[model samples]
Target: MSRTLMSLVVLIVAVYLALCAALFFFQRSLIYFPQPSAVNSADSRLKLAMPDADVWVSTHERVGARALIYFGGNAEDVSRNVPEFAAAFPDYALYFLHYRGFGGSGGSPSEEAIAEDALALFDQVYASHPQIAVVGRSLGSGVAVRLASQRPVQNLILVTPYNSLEEVAVKQYPWVPVKWLLKDRYESGKYAAHLRVPALLLAASDDEVIARDSTQRLLENFPNGVATLKIVPDSGHNSISERREYWRWMGDVLNR
Candidate 1:
C-alpha cells in the first residue's frame, strides 16, 4: 500500500480509539451529573415527596412565610445545601430539591425528568405555602425558568446561569456535532425571555464553565424590569456565591 494510504488508515484507527475512550471515561456526558449520597444533617427536615421515586427533600417551615424552592447545579448535592439556604432565608420556608438519580432520588437524570421533578416538588411546596419563589443555579436555571414560565412563581432567582446546554456543548465541543448527540436540552434562554414574575439574574464576571456571555445573554433576554442583573465581582462558576456581595444581593432578592 502507498505510504499515504497507510497513514490515512492509522489516522482513522487513532480517531476511532479516541472516540471510544471518551465515551468510556466520560459516561457522565450521557446525562446530567449526579452526586453520591451525603451524610444529611440530623435536623430531620427531609421527607419523601415522591414516594415511588424515593426523592428526598429537606423543608424548613416558617408560618405564613413565602416558600422558596431551590434547584441546585448538576454537581451539587442540593439537599446538603439546605443548611446554608435555611440560614440565608430564615423567614421563608426552604425546600431543597434533589433531582432524579441524585441523593436518595431514584431513576436516571435527564432534562425532562429533572424538569418534571422540579414541577412536582414545586407543587408539593405550594400546597401548604401559597406564596413561592424559585431559585436555580447553573443547569438548575433551566429547570427553574421552565417551571416559572408555566407555574405561578412569585419570585425567581438564578445564579451563574447559562443560555442552554446545547449552547455550552457547542462552545466546548465545537467540532463534535454535539447538537445531535446531546439529549438534555436544558434550554433556559427561551423560557427566561418570557418569564412574567419578578426575577434576579446573578452572573459571575469570570465564570469559566458557564461563560459570561451566556449568562449575559440569558439576562438580556429576560423581560424588562421583570428581572434584575447582578454581576458578582472576581468570581467564577463554582465560587460565585463565595462573595459578600452575592449574599447581600441574595438577601435583597429573597426579601423582595
Candidate 2:
C-alpha cells in the first residue's frame, strides 16, 4: 500500500474508535429522556423513601382490594395518565411511578436501580392491594416484566415492549458494538419465561419506534398460554394510548 493510503486508513480507524468510545461513555443519556411531572398536587403524589433516593409515585387512592401500577416510557411523565386512569379503573387504586431522576425523584436512573425501586413499589402496593396488576409501556415494559416475574402480580400488561434493549440498540447502531457497549440492557424476554400470571402484550399496528418483530420475539419468550398479543389499529408507538381499543384491551386484562 502507498504511504498516503496507509495514513488515510489509520485516520479512519482512529475516528471510528473515538466514536465508539463516546457512545460507550454517554449511552445512558441517549437512552433516558426525563420529563417533568404534569400533576404536581400534594394529594396526587406519593413519596417513596428509598435508602439512596426518594422516588415519587403519582397515585389515585381508592379503598379496595385491587390496584394498578404503571411504568411509563423513557420520556413520558406518568403523572399525565392520572385523570384518564382514575376514570377508567374506578374500583382499582392507581400508582404511576416516576422513575429516578424523572419528575421530582432523586438520583440517576439505571436498569438495576429502577428494578430495585420497582420491587420496593410492588412490596408497598401489594401490602394493601392483594390483587395487583402491573402495566409497563416502552422502556417501562422491561421494568414491569422483571417485576412480575419476581412478584405475585395478578396480571401483567406490556405496551410497545421490545424483546430486549440490547436488541433494539443493535438495530439502531449497526456499525457500533451495542451489545458490548450498552450498560443497562433491559432484557425483558429473559424475565418473561419466569412469569406465571396472565400477560397481555399490546402492540401498535403502525408503530414506528418499536418494530413489530421485537414485540413478537418477547411474546415468544413467555410460557405457552401465558401471554396474548393484541394490536391497536391505526396507531404509532407514542399514539397507541389515543386509540380506544388500547384502553379496552387493558381494561379486559385488568378485569380478567
Candidate 3:
C-alpha cells in the first residue's frame, strides 16, 4: 500500500470515530428537547414528586373514577392540551404529564427517567381512578405503551407513534449505527403483543416527522383487533391535533 493511501484511510477512520464519539455523548440532546412553560401553573397543575425532579401535570379537576393520563411529544408543552382535554371530556379528569426537564419539571430527560416518572403518575392516578385511559404522542407513546402493558389501563391512545426509537433513529441517521449507539430505545412494538386492552393509533397523512409506514408497522405489531389506526387527512405530525375532526374522534373514542 502506498504511504498517501494509508494516510487517507487513517484520516477517514479518525473522522468516523469522532462522529461516533459525538453521537455517543450528545445523543440525548438530539432526542429530548426540553422547552420552558408558557402556561401558568398557579391555577391548574399537579406536582408529582420524584427523586430526580418534580413532574408537573396539567390537571383538569373532576370528581370521578374515570381519568385520562396524557404523555406528549418530546418538545411538546403538554399543558397546552389541558384545555382541549377538559372541553372534550367533561366527565373525565385530565392529567397531562410534562417529561423531565420539560415545562416546569426539573432533571435531565431520558427514556428510563421519564418512564419511571410516568409509572409513578399512573400508580397515583390509578389509585384514585380505577379506570384510567393513557394517551401518549410521539416520544411519550413509548412511555405510555410500557405503562399500559404493566398497568391495567382501560384505553390506550398513541399519536404519531413509531415501532421503535432505534428504528426511527436509524432512519434519521442512516450512516450511524443507531442500534448499538442508542441507549434509550423506546420499543413500543415489543409490548404490543402483550396488550389486551383496546388501542387507538392516530396517524398523520402528511407527517414529516414520523413516517406513515412506521405507524402502520406499530399497529401491525399489536394482536388482531387490539388496535385501530385513524389517519387524519391534510394534517402533519404536529398539526393533527389542530384539526376539528381530531377532537371529535377523540371524544367519540373516550365517550364510547
- On TM-score, the candidate that comes out on top is 2
Per-residue lDDT value at 26 in model 3: 98
Candidates 2 and 3 compared by lDDT, better number: 2
Candidate 3 Cα lDDT to native = 0.89
lDDT of 2: 0.94
- Model 3, span 1-256: residue lDDT tens: 9999999999999999899989999999999898877786576888998986888888887888999999999889888888888888888988888888888888889988988998899889888899899899999899999999999999999988999998889889999888889999999999987999999998888999898788888999999989999988889989999987678777778998
Which 10 successive residues of model 3 have the least lDDT summed?
35-44
Clashes of 1: 0
TM-score of each candidate structure, all chains considered together: 0.88, 0.98, 0.97
lDDT of 1: 0.80
The superposed Cα distance between candidate 2 and the true structure at residue 163, in angstroms, equals 0.5
Instruction: Kindly list the per-residue Cα lDDT of model 2 for residues 72-92, writing each as its tens digit.
Output: 999999999989998888889
Candidate 2 off by > 4 Å: none
TM-score between model 2 and native: 0.98
Model 1 per-residue lDDT tens digits across residues 29-114 = 55467786574664634655553566766667677749889888888887667777778888788888777778767877777777
Candidate number that wins on TM-score, 1 or 2: 2
Clashing pairs in 1: none
Rank by TM-score (best first): 2, 3, 1
What is each predicted model's overall lDDT from 0 to 1?
0.80, 0.94, 0.89
